[model samples]
Target chain A: MSTVVDQPVARAARRRPGALSLGLSRGALELKQFARTRPYLIFTLLFPVLIVLIFGAAFHGDAGGGVSWTQYFVTGMIASGLLATGFQNLAIQIPIERSRGVLKRLVGTPMPRSAYFIGKIVMVLVVSAISTAILLAMAVAFYGLALPDTATKWFTFAWVSLLGVTACTLLGIAYSSLARTGRAAPSMTTPVALVLQFISGVFFVYTGLPGWMQQIAAFFPLKWIAQGLRSVFLPEEFAAREVAHSWELGRVALVLAAWCVAGLILCLLTFRWTDKD
Target chain B: MKTLIRIFRRERAIVDAVTENLAISVRGLRKAYGRTVAVDGLDLAIPRGEVFALLGPNGAGKTTTVEILEGFRRADGGEVRVLGTDPRNATPAWRSRVGIVLQSTGEFEELTVAEVVHHFARYYAGADDPDKVIDRVGLTEKRDARAEKLSGGQKRRLDVALGIIGRPELLFLDEPTTGFDPEARREFWGLIRDLAAAGTTILLTTHYLDEAEALADRVGVIARGRMVALATPAELGDRRNAMATVSWQGPNGPESERTNAPTAVVAALAERFGGEVPGLTVTRPTLEDVYLAMIDKNAISKEEAA
Candidate 1:
């Protein structure tokens, strides 16, 4: 055995390109793992669409403020889908990974911590994008809703969706720090997500909520994302149902961007790469 | 005889070089959780290419020391250098040169052994071929099996494969064979031997004294957050010169004596019996005996101090 040590081989050479390749591979693996989990895969992709279908069919008449019930509910469900992918999925997954010692194992490796984080963010973006597309398709095909027709409306959808996803994903990562174990993550995050869905108008008409409740919802990203999506897909006059009686596209963008920054800072402060203190 | 001289010269030169350029060096390393100290003013140095085993009872700071060396945790006080750089500030290149096989498997569910290894390979600049690493760990037959489907020992082998795929200059194994069966433990020891043969410096922490005796060129025992003993397994507790025990069967039943000259005692017994003594046996203190004695002494002293 000692003779083998005498060969004097050079140590392995280090390469910078490996980090990016590793991150990409990690993202791919996360996606593959998610897909292999049959229940999670099915629920993540189909739940929002199911909610939209059921609600749109039940509330087929005009939903006041010049918006059809189908259009209104579909827009809300799209927001819900984004929230599910960005916030709920990541909040649960990160804690599970930590508890399982997956994050600790990665920390032990030469893979840069930033690479692991970026890989997770990339997976969140991909899954959210796909889930959003599925919800839109369900809305248009089954609920008789029109797609974003104008270039400006598509543009609004693009930036708003991007900002919303970024904010929720960061928030999710931050929220994961509150969970002590994988088993505790669902209880920690699910109630918060469910509460946000309710007050942010995913399940009910936002305009009909109490004044204080509306003010409470205004502080969160979910409400702004729903409003932003509605502005893109609903008729122009439908903005009358919103606070300030307008789409408030500027405010929506500003609020979402602010939340994105806040979430980033929170995650930076609170997010742990491993379960250990 | 000519080959023997060359090997000796090469080995001596390598040892001299590494002793001058230690792979791991620590001084006054201290860490405390609130009021309880996990590591207390401990000092350690391990030369390159040495398989140094750390032995300790539970919570004796072995894991804490290994964690600090691996850069997984920071010390409250003291200087630590692993591969000539402070682990706290070590860059990605530095990290790439270190490998850690943690006590728990990484549990990369749903991915095959080959896939996980290939994925981890990308994290290093010049990683070993994933297939070769798989075969090296003796997992070629189960290379296609998902990580979650693997048996306990197989998972440990996968952990080692990932740890060495990057060809680390320093490898840390923390109680790596806790759940492994005896056969599996032997297999794991063989893998460790192969890595050491290839000159990968290893810092292994284990509770098993036999394992330390089998694999470590030198062993350090820690107790109460401090190093109680550091020596080669044979030299620990001065076991080489420690009194040996000789036992023999007599007409009455059995007799045993602890003596410095066991061979003399056995000969005297042979003469007295007028033939080979029945059921005579000679034994020295095993590694386990030395280890237990060292730990017990430390515990007693600590209690007295408190």
Candidate 2:
């Protein structure tokens, strides 16, 4: 029974593929699965646009330093969109995957463990980019906002958005380790994200908040990301409304980069592929 | 005595040959969760292309040992090798040769069965054809159906399909048929037999003795974190030498006696009843009976140790 059957099967085991291709396929499958979920699709694509429209219409006057409320609100909602797609969504999705045994099943496979995480990161980036583009398009079409006028401003937008997404996604994966079950994931993640959004100036201007609140907001990546986005889209004179009456682009970049490094270390230490207990 | 000697020689030769091609080997394996010892001083050796069934009661460390072998958990202390590599430090190349069917169903919400199977196929270098594997598991009809829509048995079949799609040389089945109906279980058993026939070594942990008897070439019975017995299904608990029971209708209605020679007892009863002993029957211990006895003996030993 052994000799006759062993030869063919052993010969068939010789063809191993590259991990990159496998990761790409996994990313593609994730995107397809996400597309099929109606509620998540609607929320991720429309929530930011809804926030921009509602806030832009309600606050009709200028925000500060001659920047119209519509422009300020558009940039803030874009930052909020990035946080929603990259951090909040992943923090909830990962724990649900663990509780459902999907992550456990993936761990049992021959796939490289890094490939699984890379696939997830890739999916988050792609989804966030799509949602960000949609939010920008809505802002430009309905709110009379303009796209970044110069290549330098576009470059700044590119790096700032990429760093922000990477940092938030890593933080989300790290935070997912705290969730014990799929049912508990929303309760675990939503309150924290909501608090961060409110305090980091997603819904209001950070400089107008109290001194203590501004100090606290300076520690997180969201505030820096929002400030960076404002520098890209708002008028140059609007920098007067920021802290110390300067754009502080260098400080924004440095803080987001530091958060990216810290979030990566936290993710490496805390992210669990399965529910071991 | 001559037959016994020949059988002993044959078994030794088989062991010697298998030792050179062991798919899984363990020595003095120990694992504990905080204060509870799950596997203690456990030893095992499974040969290539052989289906080895590990039988035990709940919390007997069967699952823990299998998880360690599958590289899902690290052992506290032991020498362990699966597919000639230490699972604790196994590379992705080494993992490609091993397949695992876990006890719980894997949930891939909103993903079609074909999509999930096809995605997993890309993970392995020389995976089998996903459509063919789907057909083999009898899920071809539901290939495009979402995973959440599958029945319990269908979900199990999908698990098997994924486990085998890699064309793994060593497959781990952890209670693969736990929720299967009778017919589904028989079908699943047939699928396992086909894999074994194709020279895929299988390490199975199951609570069902009937499954062990039907599928395993050798069965290891574990209890209280230790292997109490290891033998072929027919030879477990010395079932062949164990006394059988003779029963018949006597003057007192029904009579039964335990004896080494049931044929002799039945003959005496026939003579006592003139020509025929009404309702005469001879029965040997079933696999379940021997298994229960072994468990009881192990429990007593554990109590004595404590």
Candidate 3:
């Protein structure tokens, strides 16, 4: 008996996998699970496409400068796609996972909490990229929107995505703690995402909104993300219609970066492995 | 006298070994939620390689005490050492040594059983072979099936597979056989026995007296947040020495007698019949009988205190 008891203790002295590697492995598993859930995958990817088609058709013609309403709405929907994947999806999913005891089970293992977050972030990044690509394809094929033609414009698109997706994903994780149960998560998360989309210039034109609405939208990451993507999809001359009278690219980076930090802190403070008292 | 002293010295040496190599130790453990006391002044010590069952009625602080030991909840007051480290301060190395099968958990509905097992195996420093673990739990047939497709029994088998995959020295099983069918329960018991035979220190909290009697080396009965009794199944409540019931057919009708001397009573009944006694039978208190009586007494005492 003593010999058997000593066996596991000796095994425990063996090397553990690095957290980063484990996190990446978890990310792959997360992606596989996400892909296998057919309805969730289709709905997540199709939403932005439907938005681009419906709004692009309803609101036609030019909206100042050389950019048409269809082109402008396409960019806005692309930004919303990122939000839908990173923010809306996770805010609802995390609570469901929490209520289901998935988080609790994971916490029971030797895996680090940071690895769990990393895996989630990785999954969101992959899903958001797929969603963005679908929206981009719809923009070019249906709306005749041209792809970004210059190196600088593509650079702008890349950075905006990295910062915006990261910020929204972290904030989604943070907000999930507020949802009490899996049944309540969608109601709690959907409204916030929709309300942000409306106020953040995804639904309506930013310059066309009332000044107070613009001021209110300025405090959130979604507004800056949409604003940043608009600079990429629309022509350079379209920047004149922005609230700042220019793209204000630097401020977009700063605000999104700041929100990323804030989201991380909130996540750290409120995150719980189990919902039980 | 000298021989008796030698036996006493041998027992003392065994006690010293137990003290020096305790797997789990708790003293004056207390926990309260708001104004409600969940666990109150509970003390427990389980020696290494012992399969111990904790039996209690609902709301008896069984789950609270187990969760605190598993480091899922904080104790309001107590000293606890699991694997020689405070559970609150347990490190990844410490977690690696402990496995927990909660009463219920959300399964990865989309992931195949094999995939989920492989994923969790990455978290442990000394995980067993994933294929072998699946085979051991009798899930090899369902290895390719999604978790959502598993029945209740299959899901529990998956849970057990995951619990032991990490090669943990200590395993915590909380009401593991709650929903199992009779045959499934028997099979699960066999698995538990095998793990115990391999020297896993198991802390099992169950409502089943027969399960405790079947697997545990010792059983502790808890009531109102305290350890009411602790002993081997046969000796619990002094059951082995308890009065037995003898019954037989009489000319008047059926008759029975309760006495400590059941064999003598049975012999007298046989002699009176001048042969085999009609409907002759002897009965001793079962583990369930003793367990229920203990719980009933505790309830009566609690009502009196209130």
lDDT of 2 at B259: 98
Task: Kindly list the per-residue Cα lDDT of model 3 for residues B1-306, writing each as its tens digit.
Answer: 999999999997775565557889999999999999989999999888889999999999999999999988999998888877788886888898899998778457888999989888889988888999999888999999999999898898899888888988899999989888999999899998888888799999998889999988889999999999999888999999999999888999999999999888988887888999999888889999999999999999999999
lDDT of 1 at B245: 96
Selected candidate, larger DockQ, 1 vs 2:
2
Query: Chain B alone, TM-score of each model?
Result: 0.92, 0.91, 0.92
Q: Taking the true A–B contacts (Cα pairs closer than 8 Å), what share appears in each candidate?
A: 0.53, 0.63, 0.63
Highest DockQ, which number? 2
Candidate 2's DockQ: 0.54
* A105-206 per-residue lDDT for model 1 (tens digits): 888777877788778878888988899889888778876778989999999999989999898988888889989889999998989989988999888889
Pairs with steric clashes in candidate 3 = none
Backbone Cα, N, C clashes tallied per candidate: 0, 2, 0
**In candidate 1, residue B296 scores what lDDT?**
89
For every candidate structure, what is the RMSD over all alpha carbons to the true structure, in angstroms? Answer: 6.3, 6.0, 5.5
Compared to the true structure, candidate 3 yields what TM-score? 0.94
Please provide TM-scores, in order, for all candidate models, with all chains considered together.
0.93, 0.92, 0.94
Runs with alpha carbons beyond 4 Å of true place in candidate 3: A1-9, A12-14, B1-19, B249-255
